[model samples]
Target: MESYGDLLNNNKVIFDDRNYGFWKSRMKSIIGGIDRLAWKTVLEKWEEPTIKDEKAIHCSVGRKQFELIQGCETAKEAWDILQIQYEGTSKVQSSRKDMLASRFENLRMEEHESISDFSSKISTLAQEAVTLGENI
Candidate 1:
């Protein structure tokens, strides 16, 4: 009986790196054991259009890279998947930074005005009230 790794080894050329060979063979084994529907599900999950966390982008990108190294049908498709994931993650990070900056600016403006402006207004109001009461 031939293992899935043997079949993949027969089909593709092995690289010089032992660790790379092990993972490529492992991925091939997993991919080969499954039916087409299961394979499609796995690939779809790896290339899913949505992301919940920044770290998910790394997984998606890594999957694409592994697929490319394992000789996918289309390199461009793998690249496009990686690009989309990276873009989405970057956008989220950028939006978070913008939100933080806006909050900081608001806090700075409030701090600059609240203490000095309130004290000056209170002092002026007290002086005017005292003057009016004295005249009366």
Candidate 2:
């Protein structure tokens, strides 16, 4: 059997509209979730009794989400934000394996499953990230 990365790199799903849409929606949802988490983290550190310009904060967070979603910067940054967001999650305390497993649950599922599964899932995700390159 061909590997997941091989299939992804081979353009197996490149022309599939449904798959594309699914990935797009999934990515949007993931980014939104991450953004909200990050915003909450900022809130924890924000010492103000109440936010005066909530609209500005929302807009700024939205824009940052856009940039990160669009792949304007390195995946390392996105991953960092994800870690931060996960840190702010209600039950998650340590920013370690448990945290990553909780945050990227889907991705973590294949970690101990199979190389093919791991490679394939990651490959498709990487492709999605690449798609955001010019849009950022």
Candidate 3:
């Protein structure tokens, strides 16, 4: 139930291109928490809420990241650019998905590894796969 103002004062939602997956999720949660229409503006066509949503995204990114979407007219356009930059094109995504599947298939706990450590490794791989639009 956080307000838009609360998000403005929070730095945790900022994107710096280091962890695009995490940043994207946080941004979606914050924007959607404020209003579902605002989140829709980033996914659907441009609308009345686009300006505010675009501004929120524009302000939350670092200088380098800002430059990537400075010319974008809508939040959705900016989001698409950022996604492509980090996630790559569909072909690249397919390659990554294949690699992740291979890793998952070959993944095995080491003899000395703790159960928690092994679980974490599996979770990380699963998250990365999910981030790439894979069901794994």
Choose the strongest candidate by lDDT. Answer: 3
lDDT of 2 by residue, 1-136 (tens): 5442333344322212234334334434433344555344433444343533222212223343534434413333444454344234434443333433443445665436788887777665555443333111
Which is superior by lDDT, 2 or 3?
3
What residue pairs are clashing in model 3? none
TM-scores, one per candidate? 0.20, 0.23, 0.85
Per-residue lDDT of candidate 3, residues 6-116 (tens digit): 776674566885778788877887778777687886888876533354567888889999999999888789999999998999999999999999999999999999999
* Best model number under TM-score: 3
- Write out the backbone clash pairs for model 1: none
C-alpha lDDT of all candidate models, in order: 0.40, 0.40, 0.83
Candidate ranking under TM-score, highest first, comes to 3, 2, 1
At residue 134, give the lDDT of candidate 2.
Answer: 19
Off by over 4 Å in 2: 1-16, 19-106, 134-136
Give lDDT tens digits, candidate 1, residues 9-87.
Answer: 4544332222332333344344545344534543454444363222211222344355543443332344344434432
The clash count of every prediction, one per candidate, is 0, 1, 0
Which RMSD values do the candidates have, in order?
Answer: 25.2, 16.2, 2.2
